[model samples]
Target: MPKFAVVVCPHCKNAFIMEPGHKTVSCRSCNKRLEASRLKVFFASDDFKEAQAARGSVVAGISGDTAAFEEALPGIGRDVMERIGEDVQEQRYMEDKRKVNEKMDEEARKTKKKGQQAILRDTFEELAENGDIDIEEYWKKISFSGIDRLKFDKWVEKLVETGVAYSPRFGYLRKS
Candidate 1:
């Protein structure tokens, strides 16, 4: 038995484990074979460094006084900052929804199901009618095994592909 760490294939971009003593493995994404020695280990320490670098880059890019935004506004209490944050979040949500709709429209033009479209349509319709669809709850209701999340995601992708469901501001919504 050899120790292994999950690595993303540079050639195909698929995630695969790098087993010790194995020099190469086929990528699950593009099926391109990649050398294990070329893979980079993304450990917690590496992740921390990456986060720190990203934060530093963002801070460096901002020219104005970042502290000014942190100060409390006139006639508003501590909740003012929270409210602004919420508003910004809502804007981001709307932007993301627009992008999803565009992606769904594009996917609908494609001619193939990729094997999960029917199931996805049923699930999306059910969720749209109910106005709520928690992944865990859906799994429980359907009696899915632990591995079913992958299947569910695939189905969701198909639904998106067929333009039957689009993740909007609050949750998944059907195209009207």
Candidate 2:
């Protein structure tokens, strides 16, 4: 097997492992043709895996990540790899949580635009106990619906006109 060499491309500065003895090699990143003999070699090894590790170190160094470059060196241990796996998992978890929150926000916006008075009416219906809604309780529950008292009164008037609800007394309303 031809011994592999870890080299950096002069044009793009990206590192990659390649075999020696070739007259020319194309840079993996920039695709520029370079004379193999002229290219600066960072490391050379008979083992392809060792050359790959050296290439990783060179790439990490080029990216300005010191920790990753150090991890690419031999005798780093499996604990570092495990930590990288955990970090990736945590990133994915956070991304998933953000997506869920965005979806909930979108759903809330759709519900908010559906019609405030309609939501308030539904809330009033839900607030009704024993088939009669206490005006005070209904007002308290629909506070978040953004419907003002005048608007609610007009809506209630419309409801009574449309035969959907009726005022049984001064402080209670019931659906007809």
Candidate 3:
């Protein structure tokens, strides 16, 4: 047989019924997250009658009457509370780390794009001033600045994309 117990959401002070082992539920009234494991169950036994008198008041155990409720609710152990705290802290830490990583990745992409734009600008200026695409001379000009020949080649591709310059022959650039 399905058993039902009167329980209240610890988060929102909303009273609701729950199965004995239903460990999570959402509050209908406030829509706040409710830990069903934290829900105080009402026992039909007379031993709990005095404790259940002010049902709503005792529901959350946060309304300054927690000592009596804790004495009655011995099933919720100290370790469980500790584990819950640790879990919440760990979850927050992981979320913070993920946000930091995403920000770093975005910043890295922006930096790389800026570097590429700088390379494009320098290559364009060199080509414009020289008017003749001496590919070797251009490499020698930028080599000491740590720009490799392959990097210059990629920038030359960008120049071709700009429609202001093109390769009329292999190893040569001509103004268009």
- TM values, all candidates: 0.26, 0.41, 0.41
What lDDT does each candidate get?
Answer: 0.49, 0.73, 0.59
lDDT of 2 at 142: 76
Decoy 2 TM-score against native: 0.41
Tens digits of per-residue lDDT for model 3, 1-176: 22555555545545555456566777777887677777555422233333343233334343444455445444544653343334434544665698899999999989877776676567657675767677776676666765667877878787789886888888777778
The sequence of per-residue lDDT tens digits that candidate 2 reaches over residues 1-176 is 45998777767767788899999999988999999999776667787877777677666666657688768866434554344334334544665698899999999988876778578767866765469887777777776768788877777678778988889998778888
Assess candidate 3 and give its lDDT. Answer: 0.59
Choose 1 or 2, whichever is better by TM-score: 2
Error of 2 at 21 (Å): 0.3
TM-score of 1: 0.26
Looking at model 3, which ten-residue stretch has the lowest summed lDDT?
43-52
Give the local distance difference test score of model 1. Answer: 0.49
Error of 1 at 167 (Å): 0.3
Give residue 125's error in model 2 in angstroms.
Answer: 91
Model 3: pairs clashing at backbone N, Cα or C within 3 Å: none
Please state the error at residue 22 of candidate 1 in Å.
Answer: 45
